[model samples]
Target: GKDGSPLLCGSIPGLVPKQLRFCRNYIEIMPSVAEGVKLGIQECQHQFRGRRWNCTTIDDSLAIFGPVLDKATRESAFVHAIASAGVAFAVTRSCAEGTSTICGCDSHHKGPPGEGWKWGGCSEDADFGVLVSREFADARENRPDARSAMNKHNNEAGRTTILDHMHLKCKCHGLSGSCEVKTCWWAQPDFRAIGDFLKDKYDSASEMVVEKHRESRGWVETLRAKYSLFKPPTERDLVYYENSPNFCEPNPETGSFGTRDRTCNVTSHGIDGCDLLCCGRGHNTRTEKRKEKCHCIFHWCCYVSCQECIRIYDVHTCK
Candidate 1:
């Protein structure tokens, strides 16, 4: 089956040789990788919708991932975690479906402690998904550097978050509508839920040090000593080695394209507000008329109709 199922990511451009090899090894995981990447991009866009970067993606290749990931910034940390989590969620959910030959009910988890429901209603094998995802994602950072360590840890955190959110779902069925039978299974949390969780982690991501130490015993990280005000970083936390730029003006050095020509919410007072989004550059307004369907009415036959309406609105853009 692995032979027949070619990895969807095998065709992806810009992947290094080792990454290609990893995908080939888990061919069935390929589809999950593809789906996961798309979801990751979407989640990034959602999370950064009002920001300068705006989490844009290009279709030609993975270059769209850009130099952002190359740096150990908060943005990169979020990208890694969200991407890994997306893959884990996709693969885990795939396991429970009839079409998935690669995985099925988490044999590891004993079903619901003496369940009254169907013994096993095709639960998602979340552990397997997390493991494979970690292997592939963490492999790239095998180098002996503090950045690599942080990346690996964040990757694991992503998988951990996905696995943590796997919930037990149940369904009820019975003859004559009696409440006698029930079916339960493990279900993957919605990708949005994972995105929201990661967003929270991103907001409070830790900044760490890449210190050099005597290797008498072994090579170990020493972040606690540097950032003593906070507790040691946990598997649940997102970690970064560097600070991010304000991203106000186009700076190729930091991969920021600036906010020029970008839309702004003139009336808001948050980050999306014109003052902030324009970066003290101010904004220009233009009025336009748009048409939309309105005054819809539902019919007895489950069909509805609507009439066209026109409205005018002001548009604001960064100078």
Candidate 2:
């Protein structure tokens, strides 16, 4: 039980000193924090699987992403956002499930009820989740630099993604499922929904400039959009300060592994296509034979039979 105890927060990987302190204070929520990080990383990989970067992680270091997040690129912004959102989402879910003593379902609905529906059921305590996530995740960032400011903004954007997607769920109560009265409660959208929304924001991420302000407490760094033609990014949008490297070839400087053996679509004109993914270096095509079950027949005696078939397809990879 000692190894499995939540109080062993110091054993958790990828946690900074401040985060370790936070974990010890909120021991019960440590599992959810770990779950949130896993969720965020998984979603990052899923969202960028076909792209050049592909959200690769290094197993050698507790930093997890190696030097990939050291730069304030759009890729880093997306990672920060998704990771922060994962923590909030997981904590909120745990609260709704009554797994913690400090928090529970949200009972802070304001205003009058809707026409026919009244508030009922458990609304997830998203505020508590977001607050805890901020306290824990932002603790690691103690620097007063442009990259830190960018990361903080992107992190909030990710958590805001969860809040923005919250919807009202209602249950009908009446005779034979008739709509005599309805009870509605706020519910969180699926994590995939948050990932998809953030992916869109990543595509349209705003480029920003560092503004240094002289105050009583030394110079403070802030971010402002480089382009002012459109509306500035709100709390729900991602922001980046630097341009990303072309990850077609292995670059130790940028922490890019490249796409040497990565599969590419021969016909697609998008980022996943051979042309873009290979960085105009051309691709190698190979014929692969795959075995599958074919010509299946259902027998009248509750048995089914199928014939084995060999299928050949052309596979393309970056040169």
- The best candidate by TM-score is 2
Model 2 TM-score on a 0 to 1 scale: 0.90
TM-score of 1: 0.89
Model 1, span 1-319: residue lDDT tens: 6564444555666666777887777776577767876788789899889876687664664567656666888888988898888777777767666456666767666544444666457778888878778777777777667778878888888889987887878777888766577767777888888999999999988888878666766775544324888887788999898878788887666768789988999989888999999999999999989998899999999999999999899999999
lDDT of 2 at 187: 91
Candidate 2 overall lDDT versus native: 0.90
lDDT score, candidate 1 = 0.79
Give lDDT tens digits, candidate 2, residues 1-319.
Answer: 4345644875677678888778777888878988998999999999999999999999888778878888889999999999999999999999999998878999998567799989999999898999988999899777777888888888999998888888999999999999889998889999999999999999999999999999788888989999999799998899998899888889888899999989999999999999999888899999999999999999998999999999999999999
Q: List the residue pairs that clash in candidate 1.
A: none
Mark the 10 consecutive residues where model 1 has the least summed lDDT: 111-120
Per-model lDDT = 0.79, 0.90
TM-score of each: 0.89, 0.90
